[model samples]
Target: MKAKPAKESLTIMNELVLPNDTNPLNNLMGGRLLHMMDIAAGIAAQKHSNRVVVTASVDNVSFKNPIGLGDVVTINAQVTRAFSTSMEVRMDVWGENIPNGTRFKSNEAYYTFVAVDQTGRPIPVPEVIAETEDEKKFYDGALRRRQLRLILAGKMKPDEATELKALFLSEE
Candidate 1:
């Protein structure tokens, strides 16, 4: 498969927080934000793979700020790296109060997705080539993050995570 530039998969999605999307405190609900993030990340993964994709895993998501009911939520997603049939997508979310002209980062998360065919079987996807320094950094760190994810899910043994081990190993 041909390799694709990471920027080609960039996806930006926006949503206006409403009464039904918020909690009693008039803040956007976490689940609602996560839903939007998933959609943004899914679109990015599909753009990178050119195939239907399914969410494989979601990394730790921390809510850094509460989005008010009238805030506009923006989610920026991009494919950071591709590994075989799966790719990692990084999503940054921000909430802006247009009236107040204030914006704050709501959260950031890494979501893993696997390309699938008609039968829902995993299919190979194109590799991602980093073109910017930030993209390069995310691409390089993806392996370590994947290893940790696998370890936490019991899909990979600790000893088999060479990339993660290298981080703590010293060269004599």
Candidate 2:
């Protein structure tokens, strides 16, 4: 793919976390955090494709730290690639203590979404252009993540997926 001028991809959702969005332990619920992630991803897809987007699959979502109530939880999302009708979005979550001004990484995940027309049918999406080294690295990582997604969707066998994973992860 030809590199295009580096553009801003991250769409940060600010102030989405609230007091009632917590669990019994007073931490932000995983489900709630997931919902916010999805929203941030949709916004990124929409910005990239300029079309209505719907979530197709969430590849991997792992919580790294607890998100406490009243913290400013930021959901940062970006479009890593786009096919004819689908795009991959990678997201990271961070929690900030409003009072102490401390920020901590909370979680991260990657999701796929399909761009749709007004009729709710799949449509063409824009090309993915990776400019800087960081953007290129992000795109390459997204490819491996997509392979895992194909395995999860039953389109690829476990052995093949494992092989692809090994090759993709070899550089690391």
Candidate 3:
């Protein structure tokens, strides 16, 4: 498979928190933010894989701050790493106060997606080339994250997770 720079898969989406998008407390609904993040991550995966992609899993989604009505929410996503047929997309969310001209980070999460053919069969995707230090760190940790997720899903054995083992069980 060909290798592609991680930046090639970057996707950004912006949304305004209208009354319809918020809860009764006048804060943006968590589900709405999640939907936005999913859309952004999906676009990134599709751009990187050049194939139809479907969400396989999501992890560590937590909101650090509330987004109020009239705020602009921006979600940024990028491919952190790519496996045989799946990719890990990292999404960062920010809330911008238009009136105050201030923006603050709200949350971040990781999403996994698998490329599929028209027949809905899994298909291989290009490898992600991490050019920046941060990208490289995420790319390196992808294996550990995959192992943990698989273990949690009962798809893999804890003893077989070499990447995770070395991470926490290493003598050094």
Most accurate candidate by lDDT:
1
| 15-118 per-residue lDDT for model 2 (tens digits) | 64567899888899998888888899999988887788999998667889998877888888888877678888888889999799799999888889998988
**Top-scoring candidate (TM-score):** 1
Candidate 1's residue-wise lDDT over 81-169, tens digit each? Answer: 99999999999999999999999999999999999999999999999999999999999999999999999999999999999999999
Candidate 1 TM-score, true structure as reference: 0.98
* lDDT tens per residue, model 3, 35-139: 899899999999999999999999979999999999999999999999999999999899999899999999999999999999999999999999999999999
For each candidate, the alpha-carbon lDDT, in order, equals 0.98, 0.81, 0.95
Give the candidate order by descending lDDT: 1, 3, 2
- Model 2 residue 93 distance off true place after TM-score fit, in angstroms: 0.7
- Model 2 local distance difference test score: 0.81
TM-score of 2: 0.86
List clashing residue pairs in candidate 1.
none
* TM-score of each predicted structure versus truth: 0.98, 0.86, 0.97
Q: Higher TM-score: candidate 2 or 3?
A: 3
- What RMSD does each model have against the real structure? 0.7, 3.2, 0.9
Stretches > 4 Å off in candidate 3: none
Worst lDDT run of 10 residues, candidate 1, spans: 29-38
What TM-score should be assigned to candidate 3?
Answer: 0.97
* lDDT of model 3 at position 49: 94
